[model samples]
Target chain A: MGDVVLASLLLPLAGAVAAAVAPARRTVAVVTAAGQTVLAVVLAVTVLRDGPVATAPGGWEPPLGIALRVDGVAAAVGLLAAVVVTAVLAHACASPASTGPATEPAAGRSAYWPLTLLTLAGLQAVLVAADLFTTYVALELLTLGAVALVALGGRGAYGPALRYLCLAVLGSFAFLVAVALVYARTGTLTLDLAAAALPPGPALTTALGLATVGLLVKSALFPLHAWLPDAHAAAPTAVSPLLSALVVKGSFVVLLRVWTALGGDAALASVLAVLATGAVAWGGVLALRAAALKRVVAYSTVAQVGYLVLLLPLVTPALAGGDGVAVDVARTAWQGVLLVLLAHGLAKAAMFLAAGTLVGVAGSGRVADLGGTAARAPVVVTAYALAGVCLAGLPPSLGFVGKWALLDAALTGGRWWVVAVLLGGGLLTAAATARVLAATLREPGPGDGPPPGTPHGREEAPGATALPTPRAGERWPALALALLAVVTCVGSAWLADLVLVGAPPGVGG
Target chain B: MSTAEVYLVLGGVVTLLGAVRLLTTRDRLAQVIALNVTGTGTVLVLVALAATGGGEPDPVLHALALTGIVITVSVTGLALVLVRRLDREDDGG
Candidate 1:
């Protein structure tokens, strides 16, 4: 079991190297993705049967050698990553959009396969890392891969990629500073050991504050989220799904680990919840107004990130209450969080892939251009709408199950404000999603072409028969992911059980 | 105050200055330089922190500092390449 856990991480990294050298980069990438998916399922099943699995390489343990553990949370997240990454790779394989003019540079095209594999490897490392410094290193690898992937979008991507790099690098330094302080005080780098040894002092508080700030920036939470939309929107179509789905969540998992390790603080949780609310409102409004199709999906990611942070306030021991009540609430909230993360990753990736397909058919990225797309690309359009419904937490989708659990937890905690935000955010998300669906599903009016002499619309001929048909490869991957997002809700109870095994301290057995 | 304290203060001040300059600067090159300055200060702090142990400098912390240096170098190289790309794009126009 332990060997399988280790292979799940190493295989992708090894594949990255092989892809870098091999002439058949895509084949290398595909084979790696398929293998990793199998490893992830094996890891998940082993953990489910036997509880958490852990290993300290070379028989060395914490304080000297790093520990890698697969708890319930890590297993669930790893499974989500494997499935989503495979679907995304399948989508990329099917679509020519991955090698479009936006990725025209030779470096961009060839580098994508290796970078994708590297990112998967990095995420796996981040998931299992038991020490602060190791997590930091893993995060840096993840950031490097993500930044380079953004640059693969060619000219329009350079600015966003650079901005992302600067902020990400700065955030990493701040995280490193926190790690140093942590090591200084505890004389240990392993999370559990350091948490146990850490004295509550000015240094501990400072370290926690610095780590929170750094992670907030990396996770792109609210006001610190300035770098997300452009970077995500401008990324090559093949890369955007991975960036939006998984990379941002990597730091968030680290944040959850750090916050839990040091003990949750009510004040910090409340503050985070408030910022999350801001992200929901701010991101939804912007997404509603976003002109481009991909930008809408990008901004929606900002809003969804808000929902994920709601877990903090709900799970905080001080805020949730005492004894089994607290444990119960925390467990419910954690399950909700896992469901939200998984559902968002699958649904969001599907949305991006479908949006990419629509853009391909329309030959432009404008939401306006996507009007009447239902006729030309019904499968992709249906896929986009289904994913949007999942994002909005409609019935039968995994997102709905997740949000229901969150709402249930909030009600139990008697946090009326949180309950309001939960419901209100869903409505806002539905509205924003409706904007795009409306555009795509609407029939083209008789005056589809520019009236008289509109200069910008001159190039677009009305009812142009030149629109490309989305291939089965392009169409099927998005639909498959969308279907998975909805079908997974059927397994919500089983997923909740999986999340309970080796659950965190506040969440009971 | 001991030598370690002095180095800690120096590192903090340099990090602060670099961060402020990085935020305020409009020039991309200057921002990249500021990031490097910030990185250097952070590494100095990490090394200084090791010395505060009141014995031989800690190997683990030194290793962390070395790791930080490598990350900074690679990131800086990537950043400079991005700046050059943007510059070329502008020139092509």
Candidate 2:
């Protein structure tokens, strides 16, 4: 088990190094992503079968040395990171759109493989990091890698990337202060240990508040989401999926840790619930209004993030009251959030990858220009539509299952506001997605260029340029992921069971 | 007041100033510098707290402070690199 944890971390770091220096960087990256996926599955299975797996690196125990622990949350999210990274890498490996043209510099291309692997390493590290300070470091690695990936979009991306870095670093520093204060009070960096030892007071409350604020910034949850849409939309096509699907989730998981440790303070949870409501409404409206395909997808991310935060308010033990119903609500909320997270990751990756393909082929980012996309790239269009089903929480998809769980819990608990948000947010999501679907299904107008996927067809629409023939390699992965999002509903029962393996006190049945 | 309390107050004031500058400034380089200042302020607070154990400093707090500094420096380096890249884009475009 320890070896699994250690290898998961080191394998990617080592692959990152080799990819940086090796001539066959693509080969190295593909192999590493596949290997990491295997490791994640093994780790998840090991934890599910034998309970939680933890390791103390360098033979040192807690309070002296850091430990890497893989409980149910880590296993579920670790598997997510592996699967999403592999799918995006598969797409990137085949698409020259990720790298520059042959005449241009290869620097971005070379940097792409190594940085992505490093980001994966950071993700793995954060999942297993049992200490707050170590989480800070792992998150720094992830943030820096993600910032660079955004900049790979070239000049347009630089400003957003810089803004992302500045804000993210500020958030990290705030979190560090919280960690420092926690240490000053408790003398231990191990999270569970600190949580057990921490006494309620002004200082502890302040530490918790700081940690929440810091992580919320990183996760781009509403009011603090100023940097996200631009950064995600401006990132390289391949990088955008990874950023939206996985990067934001890392900080979110950390926030989950902090909240679970605090056992969901009612006041904090209520505040978060209000902010989440704002995000869903604001983000959904912006997504609806956004003209560019990628920005629409990006804004949808901001909205989806709100649903993730709804978990906190529902999970608060106060809601459970005395009938043991609150405990069941907390348990249901936890499972619902994780399922929503998994569904969103897979679906969002498919949407972005398909969006990139559409944008690339159309030679424009505008939704109006995608009118003929179905004729030109039917597979990509299908992928995008399938992803939309999950995004809108349509039936027989994992998104529906997750949202149903959330709705059931909210209705049972009589959390009317949460119920309103869930139902209303679903309508908004469906409406937002329908705009793109409507455009794609429209008949090709005069400016819409060619109607068929000719082997060598070029988009002759105004301001458009010739692109490489759309390859099967680029189109299939998006469909595969989108299909996975819909098909995984079959496993919802199993997933609900798996998430309870190391359930927190008062959380699971 | 004790020396530790004095340092803690100073650190708080400095952090507040840096945070204000970080929020108000639009200049890229200034923003980076402001972030560094804020991080230094945090380190200062950590250092002051390291002495709370009487005559001997808490080794763990000191270690955390050091780790904080290392992280701040690297992030600063990365921010500067980004600033320079942006500068090149400005010149070329």
Candidate 3:
């Protein structure tokens, strides 16, 4: 089992190297992506069938050696990431070879695939990291790879990517400083060891505060979200899914692990909850007001992440309230958070891919310019609509299921204000989605003939068909992921069982 | 305060100063330099902690320092490229 866990991290990294060295573009991209996906799926299954898997790189243990451990949450997220990466790579494979006067430089294309694979490796490393130092390394890997991917959007994207790079580096620095302080006081860097070694003191408090602020910046929770819209909106469409859906969640997962390993605290948790509530409201309002399709989805990410942060406060029974009641509320909150993460990962990726295809066809991402898009690309439109429903937390979808669970937890915890925020955020998301849908459904007015000066004539060229069409082949991947998001809700009972497998009996709920 | 404590305090102040400079600087290159300085300060602080041997040099801190170095280098490289790209875009017709 340890060997399997180690192999899970190593194989993708090896595949990434092979992909880089492979001369053929098509072979390297396809093989690397497929190999990583298969490895991820197999490992996820192994983690699910067995329990959390842990291993030291060599034979050392604890404070001396690094350990990687994966629980049910990590496995689920790993599986979701694998699915998203596979879908995006498949879409890239099918799309036209992007050789044009305006295509991104060859150097940029060369850098993209390798960095993407590296990013996947980093994410996997993060999911399983059992020590603070290893987790920090994994996060740095993720940030570097992500910054590179963001810059691949070419001229229009460089500014945003640079901004993101700066903010991410600063966050990493802050986190590193905190890790140093913790090490200085506790004499150990492993989270479990630190928890054992250090008593509650000023050093610990400072460490936690610094680390929390760094994560808040990296997660782009609210006020620190200055870089997200531009970075997400301008990145290559294929890149957006991974960035918005997977990378940010990686940091949040680490934060959870840190809190858990530290035996969990109430005051810090409440601070996080209050911030989360603010994020939900702020992100939703901003998302509703965005004019670009990608920007809207990016803002929606802010809202969804707030929901995940809410789990931090609600996870501890003491934070929620008294014995049985608090326990039940916390359990519900955990399940809600997990479900939301799963659903949002699938739905958001699908939505981005669908938007990518639509933008490819229309040659624009302006929401207003998308008028009559549903007429020309009904399948893509349908995919987008389904994704939107999931985003809005409409009934019968996974979003709805997750939100319902969240509300139940909120209500049970006597946190009526959080419940109100969740509902309002959902309604705002619905309205924003409707705005896009309405635009797309509108009839083509006299001025709606493929926005002035668009290269409509060029689109009719022989090789132009290679550009994504809403036709059957291009539609299935997005539709399938979107459907998976909806279907996962039905598997809630099984997921709940899995989440509680190793948990102390009756302690969880 | 002990010598080690004084050194740690100085390192922390330097790190914070570098961070503030990085955030407030208008020139991209200057910001990158400030970021590098901040990273160096962090490393110095970690090394100081290791030297004290109060608990034994934490391997986790070593790993974090190594990772931070790699990330800082990569980001600096990328930032240079972005700055060049911005300049080119501006110069282009």
lDDT of 3 by residue, B46-79 (tens): 7676656655666656666676777778878888
Give the worst 10-residue stretch by lDDT in candidate 1 chain A: A449-458
When 1 and 3 are scored with lDDT, the better candidate is 1
RMSD of 3: 2.9
| Candidate 1, A301-331: lDDT as tens digits | 9999999888887777732346777777787
Q: A340-382 in candidate 2: lDDT tens per residue? A: 9989999999999998888766656788877767777889989
Off by over 4 Å in 3: A62-64, A96-102, A317-322, A452-473, A500-509, B52-67
User: Residue by residue across A1-509, what tens digits does model 3's lDDT show?
Assistant: 78767776876677678767777755676676676677666766676687777778898875667888877777777777778877777765555322111356877776666777888888988888877777888898898888888888887888888888888888887788887787777767677678778777777777877887898788888777778888988887778888998999888887766665554567787777788888888888888888788898899898888888888777755432358887787778777777888889999988887877676666567777777778788888888888888888887788888889889999988999878888888898888888878888988566553444433212334444333345455677788888888887788666665555444222362
Whole-model lDDT for model 3 versus the true structure?
Answer: 0.76
Interface RMSD of each: 1.1, 1.3, 1.9
- Ranked by lDDT from best down, the candidates are 2, 1, 3
Please list all clashing residue pairs in model 1, or write none if there are none.
Answer: none
Better of 2 and 3 by lDDT: 2
How close to the true structure is residue A240 of candidate 2, measured as C-alpha lDDT?
A: 92
Give, for candidate 1 chain B, the lowest lDDT window spanning 10 residues. B84-93
- Please give, for residues B5-92, the per-residue lDDT of candidate 2 as tens digits: 8998898888888988998999999999999899889888888888765788888877888888888888888788779878988898
